[model samples]
Target: MPEYKQFPLADTAEGLTEAEILGWRIKPGDEVTVNQIVVEIETAKAAVELPIPWAGVVTELLVEPGQTVEVGAPILTVDVDPGGAAAPAPVTNGSAPADPQAAEEEMKPLVGYGSKTVVAKRRPRKTATATPEPVSEPVPEPEPMASVHTVSAPRGGYVPLAKPPVRKLAKELGVDLYDLTGTAEGGVITREDVRRAAEPASAAPAAPVAAGARERRVPVKGVRKATAQAMVASAFTAPHVTEFLTVDVTPMMELRQRLKTSPAFAGVKLTPLAFAAKAVCLAARRTPDVNAVWDDSGATAEIVYKDYVHLGIAAATPRGLVVPKIRDADAMSLVDLARALEDLTSTARDGKTTPEAMLGGTFTITNVGVFGVDTGTPIINPGESAILAVGAIRDMPWVVDGELAVRKVMQLSLSFDHRVIDGQQGSQFLADVGALLADPAVAITF
Candidate 1:
């Protein structure tokens, strides 16, 4: 007898409900060891790799790539006792092994990993051999296109097994569900199957669709979906008040140049974002309201203020917008803050940021300046009181010592939760930040 156990999907992060399978590193019959990287999953925050807990020969992959599996659902079946499996056939307790799906599973072969062409297909059983099937009836939809998972239990329907979303996709693509086969888990049809079935007809001659109707339909299940939900929640829940400030940052620019050449700052890549981040931290000290949150989940609603800052830097990555925080950012020196910013940006760019690093942020800075856009009303991140948007710095005419002069100028936009932050506090915090950037020597007053 083969000792088999199904591996259930575990929560990769705090309160994670589901994840989309990105890829599988192993196939059926492949020998795997404990703690071996098996599959990569994309959660609400970032993409994460999952490892198996037990080592054994792969008996079956229950879920195909691109399927969104809920936490605790079994995804893979492993044969832990493969070497001790040369025994007699199983004894059924009054249950016959002649069931169509059960018999089909026994005869199924191991498919080459990621091979879309090889899959299990079970025909609709007929009552008699002489009866002819109808010609108008279309074949059932096939499994997922990524790999051969399993043939679902024998079922009779208008077409092969397909989920509701898959059926809707087929209708949108003008594909008949009866024309294709499923390669997904339990022979369930997936969005990929519909897209693949529609490709031939699209290349032939697509119907007069509104431009790009059949272009692409990316499933919103990961970071993109999370961001959308957060944005909508923040926009509707938080009463946002935005204020703008334009500053002549000639002194700050000069300081950066000198610091770059200085021995203490050598080999460090300091950017304008680093300056804005530092300024936010400094300004937060004088006006703690910007670093506060309205906690309503407790027994009594309260406005909670923190002494230290968990500064979040909003970064746009290939995956989506991720805001990873720098813990205790206000306690660090200018050099340390600059280095942390560099590392955070690097990690976010590589899409390796952990979900834990993105939590518990007290404030955020969004540097829209990198895109050369001049200031827009930014939305405050959920759970945080305020957000700062820094715009592009350019040489602009300014009055210095009663004379017109071209100086490095930049714009700052602050959006704060009005419930926790009064207009005076928001204006004061924005002013303090602008003051620090306009004159680097103002730290002595703070």
Candidate 2:
């Protein structure tokens, strides 16, 4: 006789209560092995693959794809001994089996299950109708509803058909996909469609909607939900003071182009961000308070200063905004820093950033210039004391040697925790970063 085992949801970090089943790898009756991936689940942080711990034949799947299951809930059942003859069906309605061994076998322990004894509780079966009622002859069939105004994706609720990246973009922009009609094949929504829908009514070039169109709601979950909670907490708990600086980055840009042609930086793709990151690390040496955190939870309030810089780059991924860190960034050369930034951003954009990579960040930098924005005061990461926002670099007229000349200019916005850093220290640190970009030779003085 084969014993049935129930698999419960595994515990996750941050006390995530539930996870949505993204997909199932195996079906009922299929043989599975130990450590085989059984299902993919999306929690509040990342998508994780859950593996089966015991070899068995799948008996039942208690949850369907796209359905959210709570932690510790039984998700699937399996029969352990497939070769053995099938045991008699267990009695329904909470009745125990007649044979003691059969009853004990049914209560066998499974992975993620507690020591509590398992009991089978079945719902009452519905009675089957034996005879069919006769219908009136020549009954007229109602006309099918028009396709013009009908939503064909699904009935009762609309689930937009989009890849994870597209969905992430829509969530960040606060766009509702249920109201927009997809133009892609098979009614799949594309990223462009979501961006268009997010635009204001007057600026958007889309066609007008019907008068009675209904509104749609999308629940915030996964990375977006976690980011929201952290931001709210950080904003209320920390007193932020932001400082801005605009500098001519022509020297830095020229140096970048020269480095690109050099054999020393052959494979590294150097950007202005790498220069800014290097500058931040160099400036921190003079003003250590900007790199420290304020700890007030303990009995004695103190400033915790870090000796090394674990630089964080704010990256927007298909999963949401994630800040993956580069370990010991202050010790790296310019070329090495560029390479690390390249790999970090690429990995984050692909949704492959691990939880460990996002931990232990000492300072952060956000490149709003990529989105073509001038500059904005960025919020500090939860554990970090300050965040630097880099704006778009463009050609602007500037006075050089008492003569007007075109120079590459960029804006830098620094937001720091007021508890850890005062206005004097914050302004000095911002000035040092700007001075480095204005002339890379200033790094030698550090």
CA lDDT of each prediction against the hidden true structure = 0.79, 0.80
Error of 2 at 421 (Å): 0.8
Candidates in order, TM-scores: namely 0.75, 0.74
Clashing pairs in 2: none
Model 1 lDDT vs. the true structure?
0.79
lDDT of 2 by residue, 1-446 (tens): 66566676665444557787766787777899998998877776667778877789887776666557777666777777776786744555635455677555544434443354455332222333589567788754432221211223454445556654566567667776677778899888888999988877895587777774445565777778888998998899889999999999999999999999999999888999999999999999999988899888899998999999999999988778888899999999999999999999988877777666788899999999999987999999998899999999999999999999999999999999999999999999999999999999999999
Candidate RMSDs in Å, in order, are 9.7, 7.9
